[model samples]
Target: MASWQQIEDDNPTFAAKVRSLFDAGTNKTIATLRRDGSPRISGTELKFEAGEITFGSMSGSMKLLDIRRDPRVAIHSPTLEPPADHPEQWPGDAKLAGTAIEMPRPEGDPHEGAGYFRVDVSEVSVTYVGNPADHLVIESWDARHGYRRRTRK
Candidate 1:
């Protein structure tokens, strides 16, 4: 697992691309594990702050309960439909998988009672069609595998 800053320090270019995709829109999706081990998908907003990826849930929210019970989560970046006339111009989508750890409340936080957490990232990936739009490309980094690139027709 790695901190957001560690990933950026290790691979600035890849981090920047992933950040662009994430910043393309608001309201990303997060997947958490339920008590039954099923996946629960919920809307969320995350921020890159203090060298970490952080998010919060309203007090007593189910998402917070889920994380308190089990911190594993996956976050998907906001996405847009590809341009009908120019598929080659489509921006990629990004994903992050990690463990979310509860953090001490930050001073002067507006959501006074909300639960805040930071991710210890295990994997990150971005997928898109490459230049010329010939094939799909996936750039990925993982704690175990380091970094890799793959393409598909």
Candidate 2:
């Protein structure tokens, strides 16, 4: 896996995809490495800020314990809309591969009971649902004009 810095630097387009996914209100399912090196998967909120994604827990749950033991995590977000032009290639699934670390609770965070998880993505990829094409393209969006093609597989 590339270092977090390297992934962002080498894959700006991929990063943008991650950002778009967050903006679309996608719920990211996080897989954290357990203490015994087992995998623990849990749903996480996807919060988009500036140019990155941030996640926080609402219950300070067991998932937080798993995070403290291991930082590696994989996140998945199912597509909200099917790809218009390439139905086969983008039947619509998106995945984020990365390392996650718990961010310290802010002094006055409103969600004080909520735990925080921050991922430094290594790779962002997509796949279609039961299609001959093997990959999906991602688009970038903002308030002004909405989504535009950001990258191809």
Candidate 3:
């Protein structure tokens, strides 16, 4: 796994595109694993600051409990469709998969009693339809393999 800062340092361009997708909206979708190993999706607000990607949940929330029990998570960037007249203008979709590291909430944090987690990214990817040729373009990054790009019809 890699820290958000490390990803930024190693792959600035890819990181910027991913960041743009994440910043395009306020809320993102997060998937967690329940005790029964079932998948649970939840709405969340993520913050990129201090060289870290962080989020918090209300105390005793199911998502909070889920993370405490199993830190694995996958987050999807908000979806934004292109204007009807300009289908090629879309910014594309991004996904981040990683393990969450629980951190102690700061003393003055409003959600001090809640749960806070910083992501240790295992994978980051973005997919979009390329213009002109209209082929699917996929870019991915990982701690083990670094960055890669692929295209499909």
| TM-score for each predicted model, relative to the true structure | 0.94, 0.63, 0.95
lDDT by residue for model 1 (41-77), tens: 9999999877899998899888998999999999999
Query: Where does candidate 2 clash, by residue pair?
Result: none
Q: Rank the candidates by TM-score, best first.
A: 3, 1, 2
lDDT computed for candidate 2: 0.61
Model 2 misplaced regions, further than 4 Å: 1-14, 79-86, 89-91, 129-153
lDDT for each residue of candidate 2 in 21-79, tens digit (9 for 90 to 100)? 54565566778777788788888777655445567766557777776667667777744
> What tens-digit string does per-residue lDDT give for candidate 3 at 1-153?
989999999899999999999999999999999999999999999999988999988998899999999999999999998667765577799999999999899778886569888999999999887775468789999988899999988
Candidate 3: regions farther than 4 A off: none
The TM-score measured for candidate 2 stands at 0.63
- Give, for candidate 3, the lowest lDDT window spanning 10 residues: 82-91
Selected candidate, larger TM-score, 2 vs 3: 3
Give the range of the ten consecutive residues with the poorest summed lDDT in model 2. Answer: 139-148
